[model samples]
Target chain A: MSYSILVVDDSPVIRKMMKRSLSLSKLELGTVYEACNGQEALVVLRREWIDVVLADIHMPVMGGTELIEAMSKDPELSKIPVVVVSAERNAQAIAHLKTLGICAHLTKPFTPEQVLHAVDDVLEQVAQRSVA
Target chain B: MSQVLLAGPLGEVTKSVLSEAAFLFCDELSEGAAPLEARLVEATITFEGATPGRITLRLPWHVACEAAANLLGAEPGDDDVEANAHAAVGELLNMISGSALERWFGSGSQWSLGLPSVSEREGRLPSSAPRGELVALAIDDARIELEASLGSVT
Candidate 1:
């Protein structure tokens, strides 16, 4: 199934990288949206049908953690799986993000294979949740 | 002391990150060989928590183009290469700062990263930084400099 995804980062270059990585890996993708920060990501989520979110933690206006927190509080947005694509190295912070119910964490400098695998993993969880 | 501890991981992290993200191969430059020119762009990301400091990355114009091209999956000569280089440098520094902080300060530490900034004007290291190191890396036959210093600079 094709998935509609949102990539959120302050850097346009990194956002473009995510698109290239997904296309190069041949992952099934529907309409892919881009946002510069979490606040913009929220607007996209409201307007589009997104299945997954890829985000960076350091950003202007809003950050990944704050975005996740906002998503968690919203019923519809909460259902959409978030896969963090970040440069976060703090162990506690990563663990904290996990507590918020992120599907996966892919560190920066990640490969296309990693992205495919992470997204696939999130999809599997969605499938299982539906089955349950 | 801090310099000896940090220089290795900073170089190793830079090599790994650039290799994967930008498809750039990096080698450490010998000290005192030649200074990196000021024409390069510099990106800085600061972190605050248990340890407060900043990581500054300098990218040669050509290497920035290569990184932007690789990230965007475009040819190095593409017209958009120059436009994307600034963001590419910032993102690279963001990754380096996060990875380096985790290794240096431990994983459980709480650190908040600042929004990355890119510019031609370089930042001076803080005087409060008791010890720090500057790492020079060669990528695509061009030199990029990285300076990791402790304490915050205003």
Candidate 2:
């Protein structure tokens, strides 16, 4: 089965890389959506049926932290899982994201396999929850 | 205002991140001319914390092209395609700098980055620019140099 995903990041290159990496996964690439920042991701979320959101921590306009906060407060958006992929591995940053209930965190310079594994793990958890 | 030293973990963070990114993206990296002729793709962000500063990525034309090509999933042809190439380089710089800043400052620090500026040719450095450390890394077949200089404001 295929699921839709929303990728939010300010960098076009990273976005492209994420898309490519996702394409390499068992998941279908056509269902993936792209957003340059949190604000844009929110707009896309309202319009699309996204099962998960993959975000970067720092972005112009609206960042990952703000995005998570906004999503967490909304009854409708809160159900969708958010997985953060960033180069920031600071303890405080990790703790803050955890407070927001982020599903998983992937550090930057990660191999394509790492990205695939994270996506798979998140999807598996979501499936188990739905079954429960 | 107290003097903000560009020392400690921040400096080390900058060096390691730049080196890793360069190695991952560039074909080869090497040391070039002094006063370092660089092509800069800079993005500025304002932080609410005690320590705040701008992050910039300076890459040579070759390294920039290689990065762009890698991101685009294409092989770079010639210098004429640099405009398109730098677009990719600019985005790469933005991503690298954004992640680096989040590490130095807390993720919740709430910083906003500006659009990156890509400089193809080296420009004159300001006389008042602080002299900081520089490191180079080689990727694939290109060389990339990163320098962390202190600006007027911290």
Candidate 3:
């Protein structure tokens, strides 16, 4: 099965890399979208059927935490799983993001296998949710 | 801070980050490495928390291009390579700074990172810049430099 994905980060390089990384991990991807920051992400979310969102925490206009919070407030958008792929290392901030309903946290310098595993887990959960 | 104290962690972290993020095998250069020259990309990230400081990363253009190419699964000569390299350096600096902070301050400590900015470096850092020990690495026949300083400089 193929899944539509949204990659949100201020860096154009990271956004491009996530798309390539997904393909490298052999994940079945549909339409892949890109957003520069949380504000742009919200605009994409309003228009597209994004299955999952991969985001970075720090951005210029809006950060990932604010993006996730905005998603959670919307009934439709909240169902899409968010995977934070960041260089963030603070335990407290990470814990807080989890409480905000982030599905997975992939640290920077992650291997392909790590990305594959995290995405797989979130996809499985998303699939199970759809069945229920 | 002491060079020994800072360089050790910075080198280890830089090697690990480049390996994992860009799939490049890198070695920390202890000596005999040439100084940075033309076609270089440098990024600086500021930290705020228990201890506030700044971390700067410098990479030869070739290394930067390879990183961007590898991450994009594209050829070195691709059209976007240069633009992508600029962005990749910023992200790479972000990772390096985060790793260094976690190592020195422990994972539980709270710290926020500012957005990374790119700077032009012809050969060396400015003299006015507080010289925290520099960590140099050899990656794919190119060099990468990382410097850390305690407290804010500006």
Standalone chain B TM-score for every prediction: 0.86, 0.59, 0.87
Q: Residue B113 deviation, candidate 2, in Å? A: 7.9
Q: 2 or 3: which has the higher TM-score?
A: 3
Q: lDDT at A77 for candidate 3?
A: 93
Each prediction's TM-score against the native? Answer: 0.90, 0.75, 0.91
What is the full ranking by TM-score, best candidate first? 3, 1, 2
Task: Label model 3 with its docking quality class.
Answer: high
lDDT of 3 by residue, B1-154 (tens): 4446777888888888878787778875646666545567888888898778888888877888898888777899999997788788888888888898899889998889899998655665222364676776777557677888887657
Query: Could you give the interface RMSD of each candidate, to one decimal?
Result: 1.1, 4.3, 1.1
Worst 10 residues of 1 chain A by lDDT: A20-29
lDDT measured at residue B90 in model 2 versus the true structure, 0 to 100: 62
Q: Can you tell me which runs of candidate 2 are displaced by over 4 Å?
A: A28-30, B1-48, B78-84, B87-131, B136-143, B150-154
lDDT of 2 by residue, B69-88 (tens): 65656567844345556666
Instruction: In angstroms, give how far residue A76 of model 3 lies from its true place.
Output: 2.5
Candidate 1 ranges with C-alpha deviation above 4 Å: A25-27, B36-38, B121-132
- Residues A54-99 of candidate 1: C-alpha lDDT, one tens digit per residue: 9998888999999999999999899899999988877888898999
Q: Residue B17: error of model 2 in Å?
A: 4.6
